[model samples]
Target: MRTPPPRVLTVAGSDSGGGAGIQADLKTMLALGTHGMSVVTAVTAQNSLGVQGAWPLPAEAVRAQFRSVVDDIGVDAVKTGMLASAELVETVAALLDEVTAPVVVDPVGISKHGDALLAASARDAVRTKLLPAATVATPNLDEVAWLTGVQVASETGLRRAADAILSYGPRWALIKGGHLEGDAVDLLTDGSEEHWLRAPRHDNRHTHGTGCTLASAIAAGLAKGCSVPEAVRAAKTYVTGAIAAGFALGAGIGPVDHGWASPCRQPKVSPSGV
Candidate 1:
């Protein structure tokens, strides 16, 4: 018999555009040589233009799906994104209590097109319940601004945001500063040692799915036995290459290429030399 690949599960929304949310999380897991599974929390009618409609899965339904997967196939790591409501967030948080694997939480607040995906009421549940269960919390600039009052203007400000988010109880925090100008720098800290990750900002506008991809990649690494810092470092390298290989597909913003494993698979050599 053949050995099975590492198992990574995503609890998130579905994007019809296949760029972000559960779609991107599964793609990233597969690209990184993991067995990807999903417990979809919402179904979104979205394209490159933006989210047109969204319907969250009922709390019972979400719990049932989670129980079904985790009870049998078993998960090595879990990644969460786009829990649309407070009820759903709490439901997932409760279900996760039974899981013994590491978790990566991507507190998805909005879309690349500026459409709100998470409700305001869900923020508190995420902070109080979901975050404490996370091995790492990955938040973008806007998400950091939403979860914590801190507005990150530069790399220096990321530390402040990380500090605020760390108080929420995640073992580690990764503050993505892609929204800032110049180099795309991110800060990862365990409330002690801080690792500053800096990569040249690609001029690509097709960077949809970046947040989900990075978080899921980290979860996959953790599932395969990488340390928190090691997992984050590998994930950063993966996403930087993905962003560089991003290609235009839909009418609006396209998605980062998650399958950029080897140099031969990349579309073009980005300025960052990914």
Candidate 2:
């Protein structure tokens, strides 16, 4: 029999746009040669324009889904995004503590178009509860500032930002500097070692889902047994290609092409029945 692929689980919200959140996470996992599973925490009425509405699931529902996946199929790695509320953040954090796998926490506070995805009350919960359970915390420049209060105007401030995030208790912090004015840069550090990842800025404005894609890609790499630095480097290269190949979707910004690795691979159809 063929060996099964590494399994990565994403506990996140649903993005109807198929760009960010659970959709992006699963696509990133698949593109990186991993099997993806999901435990959705919220449902959003969204498109390329922005999120029109969002409804978070009850904590019980979230817990049930997580148990259903991890208890049976099992996960080699976990990635989380868009917890929506303080309750959900704390709930997910508690569940993460029970998981032996590496966890990637993408502290999603805002949408690509500046729309708010996280609640104001949940910020403290994420900083205190969610981040502490993370193997790697990936935050964009805006998220970094929101979580750390350290505004990153240039690359020089990335270290300070990473330091602030690390102080919150994640084993490593990856501060994404894509919002900066030059080449896209990110800093990954575990308080002792640092990896500065730099990529040529693609002139594409449709780079939606970049953060989610990067985090899930890193989780997929970890599931495949890569070290933290190796997983992050591979994820950076993959997301860079996806950004370069991004295309227009609607009246607003489009999504990064998660299938950039196998651009010509055809979709598969499952067999009729077991």
Candidate 1: tens digits of C-alpha lDDT, residues 1-274: 9999999999999999999999999899998989999999999999988999999999988988998899999999999998999999999999889999999999998999999898998889999999999989999988988988889888789899999999999999999998898888899999899898889888889999999999999999999999999999999989998999898987999999988875568558653575
Residue by residue across 1-274, what tens digits does model 2's lDDT show?
9999999999999999999999999999998999999999999999999999999999999999999999999999999999999999999999999989999999999999888989999989999999999999999989988887888788899899988999999999999998888778899999889999888887788889999999999999999999999999999988888888787999999998888757483213111111
Between which residue pairs do clashes occur in model 1?
none
Q: Report, for every candidate in turn, its global Cα lDDT versus the true structure.
A: 0.91, 0.91
- What is the model-wide C-alpha lDDT for candidate 1? 0.91
Assess candidate 1 and give its TM-score to the true structure: 0.97
Worst 10 residues of 1 by lDDT: 263-272
- The segments of candidate 2 whose C-alpha lies over 4 angstroms from its true place after superposition are 263-274
Error of 2 at 262 (Å): 1.5
Cα RMSD to the true fold for all candidates? 1.3, 5.9
As for model 1, its CA RMSD to the true structure in angstroms is 1.3
On the 0 to 100 scale, the lDDT of residue 1 in model 2 is: 100
